[model samples]
Target: MVEAAAPAASVVETVAETEPPATASAPAVVASPAPSAPAPVARPAAVEKPVKPKPEARLYRSRTLGQWIKRVVLLAVGAIAAAAILILAARGVTTLPGVPEFLERYPGEYHLPATAEPGFPWWAQWTHFLNFFLIVLIIRSGYQVRTQQKPPAFWTPKRGGKKISINLWLHQSLDILWLANGLIFVVLLFASGHWMRIVPTSWEVFPNALSALLQYMTLDWPVENGWVNYNSLQQLMYFLVVFIAAPLAAITGVRMSEFWPKNAKTLNRIYPVEAARALHFPTMLFFVLFILIHVFLVFSTGALRNLNHMFGGTDVVNWVGFWLFAAAIAITAAAWYAARPIVLAPIAKLFGQVSSR
Candidate 1:
């Protein structure tokens, strides 16, 4: 029994020695991974820039008084320089090429006799004043109408259909009145035998006008005898104003108005709106120039005498004419100041439909 127990114990010990430890024998279990930080988020690309918008176009540009004054000064200077150059060239300046021989011709060769006559009559004086008043109104309204991009007030005739601006309505209304006045004046002038003063009987007036122009440029104005006879230049200018420029202005103005034939496409195509516009604007400028020169001469030559002829209807130099002239001028100035849109709108409403745009 001892030997059998010893053999059994030896067998057990042998088996234990052959087998590995329980920890070594067990399968290896992977350790649970440690929790990791959230993956870094990708940043967005740089924001794109916005595009800029384009600027709008302008219809009219505003200018300062200084700029206008500068422009006038420059224009005057240019005119004077050009006149000087022309005169020098005409006088056979060796440096000047292509100078016309006619430029060198003096007006004395074509002068006409001054017909002795009484100064301005009462009708003449009254018509002159009327013309002056109408012209002033016409010019003011015309400028306003021309420059306006947006009409503050629009006008339509009682008949309706076509619409016109208040400024233009005023201009056209004044124009109609002026035309009537001009026609009456013309008729009266012819009946009174005063048409001879303005109308040229012969072609000789051309050279005389040139001479007068030369005299004016040289600061040697022609002898003042408007009471008796106007210089050839004066007569020509008056003729042009009365016959050419005035009619041109009227015609061009009408062509632009509603009165013109709209459906006359072929006629319109031939006599384009652009042509009428070109003629009209320049005609207005011509009238402006004539007024400026006329006023300057009236004041500078003999204020009292000139005033007497136009206002008092006499050749006699007196303060009575001057006083009347001053009063007329004052009235004109007041009218000019009062010619605002507020005032003009009411006047326009009487003739047509007036409404704020």
Candidate 2:
């Protein structure tokens, strides 16, 4: 029994020696990642530049009073120079071959028909005065209507239509009276057989007119016997004023006026308002030219005689006609001065309503 126990002990010891001794392994090492650089700071987006506004455009440049004066002086100088040149050239042309003979042949006039009466009648004289008054007022009001951007007073028709400036109302009113006067003059002219005086009856008038024009250019005016007969040029001018220009002015004025049918699209298209506007201004300019030329000729040729014929119904050159003319001028000047808003407003109120706007 003791020998078996000893062997068991030995076996146990041998097993313990064969087994490896218990040991602690070193702690596992882990490399931490290096600290990353701070993320780059984001830059602010580039700021956009602000845009500038555009400027308003102008139609006409402003002119000083001095500049306007300078312009007028320049125009006057140019006109004087042109007139001098024209006069010299015309005088030279008279010395050309056959010119004298031509002048002699035409003589700037032709005899009127036997039916045409001589001398100005009382009705004719009165009509002439009426024409003068009405035309002056018409021209003034027309110009005012054209240029007045801000009217002092406006007129609305009693029957209700588009409102017009007081100036325009005056212009239209004057136009009506002038038209009636013109119609009366025409009727009288025909009834008295005076149409033959202005209306050309011969083809020879053209050559005679040319001769008269040349004579006028040469500063050697044609013979004046307007009481009995007018030169070919005067006859032609009178005819144009009485027939062509007057009718044209009336037609264009009516086209532009409120009297025109607003809804008549076909007529509107056929005769556009734009066309009427264009023609109307030109006609007014023509009338103005005619007036200036007529006045100049009347005064330059024989002031007293012409004034007597038209104003006094006499062929004699006397102060009576001159005084009458002076009175007519005074009346015209008064009428012109009184054509303001203060005077026109009450008159407008009689026909319609007047307003500031």
Candidate 3:
């Protein structure tokens, strides 16, 4: 009976089942590489400044070559140009065969022939004016040489191209003007203290300048900061030109004029008229040589800019003195250049070379 009941329970057992799944699933994701950093931004070009190199040694050369021939040609051309300027300035060209007959009527004293007329653009006020005034004054003062007839030291053709009297009025007037201008300028120079800036601050200016000159001769040094800077050699040269030549010009000028009769007599005691004449001749030659050398240096350095300093303006003189002249030159752009306050000028003060006004 127990076996029959267990078998009957198993016979009714049953279980439920599910159906199959549908479509395929999507592919697995893989990440893309990270973007690279941006390329570096390019830099702009820098400002370029011209640099001048130092000078070196030189070897000797002869004058017989084609270079000499070229030099001579240039010299001749310059001479011709100078002569033409002189001729044009004069009413016309007239050469005396010897001293003109009018010379005898005037005095036994000799007169060096004048090179050019008294006035012109380049030879204006300072150079030509002073010269003419001095010459005329001397001639007038020396009108009576041996006797009451003063020896006209300056040569100007009288009635018939005879060396004659000086124009005392014109001469003195110009002299006073010159003295005033000179005194005022000297004062300005001191007050402005521009001279201090120009005076050689160091001894190195000399030898270094000579080295620079030598380099310039060999083209070893190129233009730097504009013009070739002055070395000690240039310092000495300029000092001599300003202090020596200028003073000499003034002294000789006064000696010839009637301004200081006592001084003239004093000078005459030291040197007779003929000796003075000799001195004058040599001095004139020196001046001529100075001008030539000066022009050469100007061109070699930079012409227009150097010339510009002559005037207070920029158009004529582009170079604005040499690089070494930085302390000296003052033009319109000075304030802009210095990054200074724009105001009416008091030059040396800006440089701290002079006290404030």
Candidate 4:
């Protein structure tokens, strides 16, 4: 065994050279698995960022213009009533203080004082022409008879005065025309049945009148169908204006002629000439009163509509009649101015000094 060992020195060195190299020089560092982070707690799906709700769009509404127009019409109706009160108040303010004594002293001769000027315009002249013609014819003829100390023979304005011939002819012509016109007009209204519309259908006119009176007196209006409306009272007023007042004017007008006024005369059969003339001035006064009232009511009811009818002729419907009153007013005013006697008595008395010789 000793001999074999001794022989291996070089060979042993060769064997050692064939072995693999050692890796002890590099050290390996092991890190503990990072402490497992606490498992995330599910927070109800992150609350979805509360998606703020979008606001909703708003809607608005408006009224139609036609509805607004109805309100205007209502206001217009109210305005008419308001005007009546104002007129009555105005008349009271101006006339109350001065008229009482005048009325008491001269009931027969009393009339509304004349305006400062005479004729208003052409319209007035045409309206009042008939009245002017009739009155003048009667007055002129009467004056002629008085002057000559005999009864008037003519039924028209005599051929006398500053323009007697012209006045006489015109007066005579209008009389015939007026008669025919009146007959036709009256028959037309009555025949068409429009006149019946104004008549009260209810027998409660008196009770209705009472209630209306109370409301008027109390300054408290009661609205049923509408407020402060006219009942029988209004109907009567309408009827009187269309029937009584207008008819009286025509009837008495015819009586101005001797052909009409004489007893047993054709015209006299309808109305006595003397009686007609007697009522003439008074009837005029009544007409004036009516005119004042009618105007006031029209203004009160609805000034615009009333004026439209009075000045422009009936409503667009043209059912209502046109007002020819302006024509009459003009003639009356012009004649009144021309006929107005100068109050020269005072000056005459002062200078009547017998002209101082």
Q: What TM-score, computed on C-alpha atoms, does each candidate reach?
A: 0.73, 0.81, 0.38, 0.37
Q: On residues 19-44, what C-alpha lDDT tens digit does candidate 2 reach at each position?
A: 97555685556889999999999999
Better of 1 and 2 by lDDT: 2
lDDT of 1 by residue, 259-319 (tens): 8999999989988989999999999999999999999999989999988888987889888
- Candidates in order have lDDT scores of 0.82, 0.91, 0.44, 0.47
Query: Comparing 3 and 4 by lDDT, which wins?
Result: 4
List residue ranges in candidate 2 displaced over 4 A.
1-62
Name the top lDDT candidate: 2
Clashing pairs in 2: none
By TM-score, the best candidate is 2
Native-to-model Cα distance after best TM-score fit, residue 305 in candidate 3, in Å: 3.1
- Candidate 1 C-alpha RMSD relative to the actual structure: 8.6
lDDT of 4 by residue, 1-357 (tens): 888887598788887889855569866567788877888877665455677888654422244566666777889888878867765654464355754454334222111123212112234223334544454444443343334432212222233222222223334445566555545545654555433434445455545555443444333432321111234455566567556765776666656643342446665565555787787557656756765765676545555544444344433323232344445456656654553113222232341221111
Error of 1 at 93 (Å): 8.9
lDDT score of residue 120 within candidate 4: 22
Assess candidate 4 and give its TM-score to the true structure.
0.37
Model 1 spans with C-alpha error above 4 angstroms: 1-61, 64-117
